[model samples]
Target: MNAQIAPPPAAAGWQAVIGLEIHAQLSTASKLFSGAPTAYGAEPNTQASLVDIALPGTLPVPNRAAIRKAIQFGLAIGAPIAPHSVFARKNYFYPDLPKGYQISQYELPVVGPGKLKVRVDDGRTIEVEIQRAHLEEDAGKSVHDAFHAETGIDLNRAGTPLLEIVSAPVMHSAAEAVAYMRTVHTLVRWLGICDGNMQEGSFRCDCNVSVRRSGTEQLGTRTEIKNVNSFRFVEKAIEYEIERQIRALENGEAIVQETRLYDPTRHQTRSMRSKESADDYRYFPDPDLPPLAIGAAEIERERSALPELPQARRERYIAVLGLPEADADQLCSDRATADYFEAVLAGVPGQAKLCANWVLGEVAAALNENAVEIAAAPVDAAALAQLLSRLREGVISGKIAKDVFAAMWAGEGSADVIIEARGLKQISDTGALATAIDAVLAEYAGQVADYRKGNDKLLQFFVGQVMKRTRGQANPQQLNELLKQKLAG
Candidate 1:
């Protein structure tokens, strides 16, 4: 499943090729082929059914919901869905595998070749091709520290449905691979197929890395970095592996094809075992389940039910709403954030940039400061929209609005209620501004004389004094105009 696309320029006469295999655990109530619960944090082996444990004479019936989710993912990426796909048994020996073989799709997969456009750190978009996305069952977990010198097996996760998404080896650096991984993670969550929780093992990535000389069309031997959970670790692991391979090659040593593990504590990768090829797995068609047949009607139904995807929403935010690409990308990073932005826009129509700034700036800072998500913020969308509406209406200055926002976040009250109680209304009246200007002129008579004598910068000093007098509620535009007029006289 290794292929190449046009990559970025080589680094120091060497080029690195990277691809990712993302395993997304499907969000279903039950296991793929059994009625066992798929909830996390259950007692050890508490949820494993007879079918999940592979009891003799227990036949598996494929869950229709899992199949439907796989189809949904295929349609989301504009990939063709196979009318007939088969499940095959991949033979392997592991302590966590209840059955001797894992049922997976090999020759005939549920999803065909697809592509995704990912934006890197430098704001350049790279189109990465996907080899395939197949359906499979997950193996149980092995707990090594649970017992004294004895490994414990947890079969609760066995028989869980997973969609393994394989990508072409077209990426040239760690940045590109991380960008592609993030794009897929956002997509599955947006499509409602997977929760995209890397910490909970709901979504994970396996990185395949190789390095070759600058001008050679021939590929180099590759290694697999197995089960990197977080985005930061993925980038670091690939970087270390690329350096390791290149250093080995330069020192007159051939790179070995093997699997490795990333140690976050040591920030290095160590050899896990020798890599296994497809032939080693001894794949064969599963006799327990028939060929999964998906009709055209099913495909159409899933396609019609899809919500407005992230890319489309991003484009609309940019072209129609006149937002910058960076703002749109940040807002559309997740579904809940985008929805909250839209809700604010709904309250105040025609203020796209303002809404984006508040969402990405102040609101974002508060969320990070309190370590809470947008959904759980103390100030919800409607309240924020109301606050923004007042600012739009010239009811309060930008500085005053921030103070109001702080109060609102503290569970005080609405913007209007707080503003009224504190008398923080903007001072835009000409008479009130003129009185403040006159008082400041009389107080700083020497500075006023210097200002008329061509010290134009003194104007700002007077403006600051006026703002202080008004308790930072002075309308900036009005204050400056009236101050300049009186100073000329």
Candidate 2:
């Protein structure tokens, strides 16, 4: 929910508390409790099955694949897995909900409490406590169209699997909350549980915000902002709400407990409805489906088959590879980017920093320019490593290597072939570089004299002249040496 509110108090009396509820649409072939297809963009009710429509005598059967994915997510966050957990029916009325109740996990959830590290702006890590992650079935869509006098109901999304992750009210600012959301987003995608596509409504965030005086530990009245999809909106909505609460508290007004909708256009929030408590939903154990159970052997199997997680990958990039914190963080932000970086390292071992620079610098620019994902890039990691190797071997200067990269991007051959065809090889020959340096020194006698008279900054001037004379083909290190030798004379 994007909303506009008053600015936060500048004085020392106010502090904000924030928590998040994230729903990740599991990437399963069918719905959580039904055999209906979970594919998007299908016609309205085509994907709904008899079970999805809640026809008489149509009982739900649990999908084992979806449960295994939930287990994978719990294990990734180091959360305890319950051997047995039950599902409940949450009763609510909506036109799109044919069953008039949602089957979900309540008192007993599959995943227990967990913790994850979120990065702040100052390069420090803080732990966000996760309350629980529970499995639930999604409600269908109610589409309101301007062309139609009445609303439309779509049951395709109904019965789809979702993992609702709740977090403790531990964040103190908008930055921390946004960072936590991003960290969770990266994690779910990395674990292959969810696609993490906010635009398609695959992943969404609902934030709980409240404000209190700085010294008090007692909590304040909180409001729930429902389903703001983007990360920027999450930050903006919380910021506006915090300010609104602080201003209200300062004016001796009480905060109302309600559900609000964010207006991105107006930059403000409006009351959607009175917030519902747990009692309001009347959650009860569902009698139709039996309690789901997991064995130790299954948990062990999932653990052993786990892929390398984001935090461990970040640490390895830092401690073992000797990369800086920022570099490590950027490289490990996504699974595909990290895999690409590691592939480059495999091609050119022992050049970790160089590999990081190229990947984060030029390669990133190229990807952004072409509007292509790293996995779909025209240049692969081995090809990039080959180009960097030519630069490392003194076959081309860094300046010339860039042109060769452009040629490769244009679908030219390997770096060596491009270099040979374009006559772009570096001039590392001592005799040739020496003659060029001497000629430049003879022409720029005034500047050469200035350099001998202790104007050390003029060294760059002499190097520039030699580079110009050699048409930018001279090896920079060799030119620097030859310039010093001739100038000393």
Candidate 3:
């Protein structure tokens, strides 16, 4: 899809123009401009180095890994990778900002002009235009109420690296905005540049929401919703903001441009502070670091290392594996589930549909019931494949296979072992099956006579009787054929 800015659907004659700025923390070992470690959950100031603390005469040196990741992300999104990008100092004052100013990109960012395809729940696909993705250093976190009458500072994240992705205000609805954000989230994680953990503050979004009258070209004043960590919250915050703006307009009140916070509990947005423009930040090139230079060779290396993205993988599953759209979507929802699905396919090649059914059906239910992920599944792919093999070979009926699967999930040995111990194998031996069928025919003589007299539906009755007489051990297909011949005679 071409990179075009399209507005979302209008609500009550007002169009919502939504844009998102997402900060994806780079999965790096050290800080962006210092050698300080970048591990989370570390005690306050323990991981901070002298440079991170901004000691006198401390110089800022760029981390190579973080920059490379930014380039990789740009390549993944088909963005232009700038040969020269400047690191600008954004001046701002906050308790968490130990450096008094943030080191970020402004005029010349590393990545420029990319687009992502967002597929909403209603099957409408829209291309969200990405303005730029710039590399920046994160600030420290403020611990509220850590000490009575005093807050605490944790500099462990002070110098962490981030790639701030800015998008154009084109989405017209909250759902479209969320679809765009989730597509970006999946892209970053699939590229292996970020963990994409919303709970860990690894990936967060800042939403810019505005509303205008239908068929109006002029844009409306936009409010910035800051630090929304989850996709559901992103949708909710935008929906509430749209409603708030419409009410203000209807009541003859002006929509103010400011920053707001989303209260997930109350499902509303509250004003945090007035929005700051670029000029407010006093952005200027940093004197401590020179402009970053990237050669064609470096960009090529990053591009060559890129894996197949999620969208492409989903298509491959549908086309190559012959999986249904819903099944492909569910398997490709996350990397863990996709990897597990492939592992099962590896064990049972040429049975993609069966593998998909089991993975999506019984396996998923078991995992949810046990409160675990696929990685911790009690019955691994190998064990499940073994059970499927038995079912295929007619060693067990479908009903007995479910019993064996249950036993396997409970930590019983392999499927074959469980089948042997329980004697639950299907009765496929013609001699034994014939004897069982004969007894069923003798017991249901009336039904048998009716079947020969053209009551063909009675075939089902005889099959059921035969299966019950054998305690569900008879191979259903074999029982059907034998019963048909006996009833005809």
Candidate 4:
């Protein structure tokens, strides 16, 4: 339902209504129709096929794997999987489309009606409802460069499978639209369904923006803004468009419903052309391919195989591990890293809190500095588990553990091996700690007397002296207790 956009009781109030359409290229082996390799970076024209070239009599055959992938995505978003779907001709004139009309899903789309919960790493989740997700073949791109007078067509990307996810007009601001887009990107990539590389055009989005009164129910005439390449661009485009619409209304000018292109350098949206309705294309069924049908059994099978979604895993981490909300969110952002963290915690006797602290801090830092993915980390869960076990047992001080981790990353050894090689064992021996404690007491008799007089601050000084004498190898837990006991006298 579209909200009314009349001027509010006040003259200056405005609300931004945004909806997003994201085009995500499906990850598959071959092109949708052409048998030519659907691979990236194959010297120009090497992967082109007869169908790609639009040679007469070359028929299009539906790729079963691509269809299955489309269905998988639909189920992932809880969308309605159409039992029977058809391909339609989206007729247009462009150098990239050799047939002058691109085959796409218009009337009977493969999927419909889904929603995604956008968590912007903020405390709130913005739930953007989905309008539909249609499976379509991507058109090849045309290149017009300053170096060449003639334009060139690259059909290497022709027939690439794409799922266009359209959202309901549930977003109220540019920031909300961006958050929804980011969440969708994260979900698809984490599921290994889409690479989500926007720079290479693996994923892209277009957002529809309009302004309305804060309390009015009527919708304003909306403008469709396209060519939003990055998150920052999406925000800037919406901001400019909203202001433009609001100004037009205030000036007694009608809001024009047109397609606009966002210029990042100028931070503005310029009119590209008037928007076209469905009839403009005259869409019809493709004679080459038969009607597509998805069965109930197949849907059931795919649903059962679906991985644990991000929100579920995040909640589980917070609930089961008692970790802070922010910490849990960070750890669960990556699927494999979350899995590895759970594995290391399984059946461990220590506090899970400490494990999370180490993982989020030192472990994550090392991985980032080395330019490595978590799955490719040199230290695995088993190794980390072994390492944390030592810290819990007071076998090494916290300072020594940092040295041990450095050594482990440098190919030194496991936790035990490094502890031995560096002679970094914790000095937890009560007798040794007591002798050192006695020396500190003698050196600072006044502080000891003050401690006996109920001063707790002097206790830290003793702990520091113990650590200094032991070269940071003193077990802090044991030293703490011993120092407290000695200071009591």
Leading candidate by TM-score? 1
TM-score of each: 0.94, 0.92, 0.91, 0.91
Best first by lDDT, ranked: 1, 2, 3, 4
lDDT of 4 at 323: 81
Model 3 scores a C-alpha lDDT of 0.89
Q: What's the residue-level lDDT of 31 in candidate 2?
A: 96
Q: In model 2, where do residues sit more than 4 Å from their true spots?
A: 1-11, 276-279, 442-458
How close to the true structure is residue 119 of candidate 4, measured as C-alpha lDDT?
A: 62
* Best by the lDDT measure: 1
- Tens-place lDDT digits, model 3, residues 88-119: 99998888887889999999999999988778
Expressed as tens digits, the lDDT of each residue in 1-489 for candidate 1 is 112444666777999999899999999999999999999999999999998888899988899999999998898888999999999999998889978999999999999999888887766788889999999999999999879988999999999999999999989999999999999999999888999999999999999999999888788999999999999999999999999999999999998899899999888999998765633988999998889999999999999998898988998999899999889999999999999999999998999999999999999999999999999999999999999999999889898999999999999999999999999999999899889989999999999999999999999999999999999889998899999999999
Superposed by TM-score, candidate 4 places the C-alpha of residue 212 at a distance from the truth, in angstroms, of 1.9
Residue pairs in steric clash, candidate 2? Answer: 2-262, 3-267, 3-268, 3-269, 4-267, 4-268
Candidate 4 residue-wise lDDT at 432: 85
Hey, what RMSD does candidate 1 come out at? 3.0
Q: In candidate 2, what are the lDDT values of residues 21-78, reduced to their tens digit?
A: 9999999999999888999889889999998989999999988888998999899889
Q: What is the Cα-based lDDT of residue 428 in candidate 2?
A: 95
- The TM-score of candidate 4 is 0.91
Residues 64-175 of candidate 4: C-alpha lDDT, one tens digit per residue: 8778878877887889899999898888888888887888888888988888777643345656789888888888877788346798888888888888888998787777
Candidate 2: lDDT over CA atoms?
0.89
Error of 3 at 210 (Å): 0.6
